[model samples]
Target chain A: MSELATLTLAEAREKLRAGETTARALTEACLAAIEGAAALNAFVRVDPERALAAADAADARRAAGEDGPVLGLPIGIKDVYCTEGLGTQSASRILEDFVPPYESTVTMKLREAGAVALGKCNMDEFAMGSTTEHSVYGATVSPWRRAGDTAPLTAGGSSGGSAAAVAADLCLAALGSDTGGSIRQPAAFTGTVGIKPTYGRCSRWGMVAYASSLDQAGPMTKTVRDAAILLGAIAGHDPKDSTSAPREVPDFEAALKGDMRGRRIGLPKEYGADLPDEIAALWDRGAEMLRDAGAEVVEISLPNTPHALPAYYIIATAEASSNLARYDGVRYGRRASLGQGDGIVDLYEKSRAEGFGREVQRRVMIGAYVLSAGYYDAYYLRAQKIRSLVRADFEAAFGQVDAILTPVTPSAAFPLGEMEGDPVKMYLQDVFSVTLNLAGLPGISVPVGLSGEGLPLGLQLIGRPWGEAELLDTAFALERAAGFGHKPESWWR
Target chain B: MSIDTDTARRIAGLARIRVEEADLPGLAGELSQILGWVEQLQAVDVSGVEPMTSVTPMALPMREDTVTSGDMRDKVMANAPDAREGFFAVPKVVE
Candidate 1:
């Protein structure tokens, strides 16, 4: 393996600042890596010229004495985030030409720090499915597979491309949205570290809305520190995003201590109750590792977990239905234009019918029905009430724990097309991660080990709202203890 | 939770998406399965619980009603598919 390919963003930043490496060189290295990993389908679009241009400017800025942690680092942006000049299609054909006039708040901040955009990574259409199979571009496969390994493992969805790109070293780190488990599950599947920060910790102004209530953008990187560095660069209050929390953002790097000598971590019983032996074993081993790091581990229960999946589907699909309504042919997105000289209503009907995919159209119909006349009180309104109960479940757990540990997924990455026909089966992928979104809590997925079939497994860490610093620190400790940061087989020397 | 073809067609109309009558059966089956999944929420008892409108329990920051939007009629219409003299043009609603 190329040792340089495994370098973290922190190391890349230090190297770039010390004059040992130029931003252009780093960007070139990432682009070269992207070229090598192209067969893995890790990128939806790659902007080498733009990336090098930004890098050259960063080099000039540094010569003139300007600074930032991400100065000149190459980053892959998930297509969901609107890049000012880049076509920000959420991996859906509907918004294929819908370029935004303004940059997403997070992407703008990345540029402010002198980070170069490699290009947009692919994702599930509108971030709806757990597998990127829903993407108009096609599914992103795992980079860790070998010959005769026909398991066809998922890289995980929505953020699968970001995870695969990071794992394959196509970019130093990438941005991914976590509407459900988009970020964390893909991270687990691809053997990378991904974080979904507390809702509002990062502004969502230009991110194409999925489940607006649950959507959050965070970093997918090779290590925990990269996640923190990226988090500090992109997180803070934004005037454009009313939902952006106005609280002062903490210096995450300053809090990344190797020692967690006297902290409390909770292990939720509900997260462990129905064990698929292997997954349960992963959790037990994770708790032991945390305990070994001098952290206190206590078993706690979030009793409402059984209801979490149900409540999440209700709240998420409900919000998804509304957020995705903007894609009607009238405004932005592909116009269906059936019946050439038809009236407005006919144009809308035709355009929507042709423009949206099956899953998106289904959600819209469901959302409109649920929010319609008589059913509102029974469905959408009732789901919102249950959403509160779910939030309370996390609030009650956080009172006793500084951070919570659990498995990132119920099972290791299954074969691609395995869950394609079954949406319900695929949704179970978010069972461990969605509750954190419901409570607006920050969470990260760290690779723990490989499954018997040689696929990556991950452990999840949940933190209090705005408590990402402590969360990353604990992950850094366990990351060191776990010693599982091996590169995927495809990248072998 | 099994949506009939008629229910599916009604939903498609409500959502303003056109679907052929023949496609309604497949859509109805899919919608029915999804609704079945959503019905799982009914099992949770949230009788006294309040609906969560936003995270952090913050109220909408209210302000006196004022029209502060920019006067960009022409600029706003620039992206419209069909616009005429600073106005978005659509087929006449009623003749």
Candidate 2:
């Protein structure tokens, strides 16, 4: 990788501002890196013509004295974000032939901000699985290999491709969405920073839906400062997305000074269950780091943590089934050919069955069952009640502390197919990360240390609803304290 | 409680996904397992709690009852599997 590809978005922003480098040069370097790193399976598509055109336009805008946060920056878009002419596949075969005539609001904002897109990154099929293995394009291999083993690990899903692209220096930053732990867990698996802002912070317009209530688009970047900058460019109210919060976009980049003075950080004991010794030790050190930075570290309790995963699955899959009901055969996407005596109903059934993958089908069926007539009161309603209790847990915790600190995942990235047989084991991957989504809050995973096997590990810092400014500020302090500089060696071609 | 293959077929019919007879058993087992796991929520005392309708606290935003977008006949029909006269074409439903 070129030195240009290794620069953080913040550093590149400075160089671009000072006329030290051009967006075309950075875009070319990143495109070269992406072309060479096809073995990583990070990017699903790379449009050099479009990327270069945009880069040149960014340069022209720079020359014309227009200034923006992401001006002249090169980044990757997740395949779920519709990019007009650029295909938005969402790593599902059902939508293999589907390309939107319109652009997703998030990508439109990025383009309007003068950022150039390298390509669309890969993801799990319909953002349903924990590993990118469920993707129609195939699983994205993590650039980071274990110290003694060369076996390729997973870059956690459904934003696995975005995480791998950023980690491998294929792009300076990338857009990733987190419904459960999609963004943060992958960022932990790779040494990157990912933040799922408050639920309604970023617009969901034009982006493919997965669990409408829990899904959020966030930035996967090399540092918290870059996340702040990238998020600032994309976060705001979109009249198009009525669920989007009607709030002013704060200057998040300006809020980061690496100062933790007069802040209270909470460490929930419930997250300590099933945690490995190395991760536990690192969690302790993370708290110490915050304490050393002049923050009051408190042992807080989020009592309903154990029920979070089960309840999250119940609610998420239910919403998923409803949100995914649009892919009927007649409108768009894959359409199964009708047989003799078949009608529109058969078209709907056959098209959906053939289009959706096993995991997606599994979740959709589970969702259908839960939301069905007989199961509604027993499952979906109960889960929603549990959702309220989960939010109550966080509300009470926030009353005692400004931000809560916890490990992003119970285990680091494992090898692909290690837990492939059972779906429940894979669901456990989001055990610690789902409560925030259920409660509609902001959370960031900053790489704090490496595991005993030399894989990168991250700690999550969750904030109250719409409290991303303080959350990013605390993450900056943690990033400064950790000084995580480990990068994956170029083992994959 | 485990789901039988018959119930699985019924659920598949409800979801509008054609599951082969052979796949029904597997789908039923998976659903039963997931539902069994999520059954833990039943133990919680949610007797008086109102089920959460939205994750965030915002009321549903409403706009004037006016057509905000339309008139792109070609663009609208662009991604359809089968279309004629700018309308989606499907197999006949009448008997």
Can you tell me which runs of candidate 1 are displaced by over 4 Å?
A: A1-5, A146-151, A491-493, B62-89
Question: lDDT of each prediction vs. the true structure?
Answer: 0.84, 0.92
Alpha-carbon TM-score of each model against the true structure: 0.95, 0.99
A332-428 per-residue lDDT for model 1 (tens digits): 5677645556887887788777777777787778888888798888888888887798888888888898899999999888777888667778888
Q: Which lDDT tens digits does candidate 1 get at residues B22-91?
A: 8999888888988888787777778899998897665555546777567766544444555666665566
DockQ of predictions, in order shown:
0.61, 0.86
i-RMS, every candidate? Answer: 1.8, 0.9
Q: How far is B45's C-alpha from truth in model 2 (Å)?
A: 1.0
TM-score of chain A for the candidates in order shown: 0.96, 0.99
> Tens digits of per-residue lDDT for model 2 on A1-493?
5789888999998999999999999999999999999899999988999999999999999999997889989999999899998888898888978878999889999999999989999899988877888998989999999998989799999899999999999999999999998999999999999999999999999989989999999999999999999999999999999899999999999999878889999999999977889889989999999999999999999998998899999898899889889888777889998899898889999999999998998888888888999789999998899889899899999999999999998878899998786999999999989999999999999999988889999999999899999999999999999999999988875
Candidate 2 A-chain TM-score = 0.99
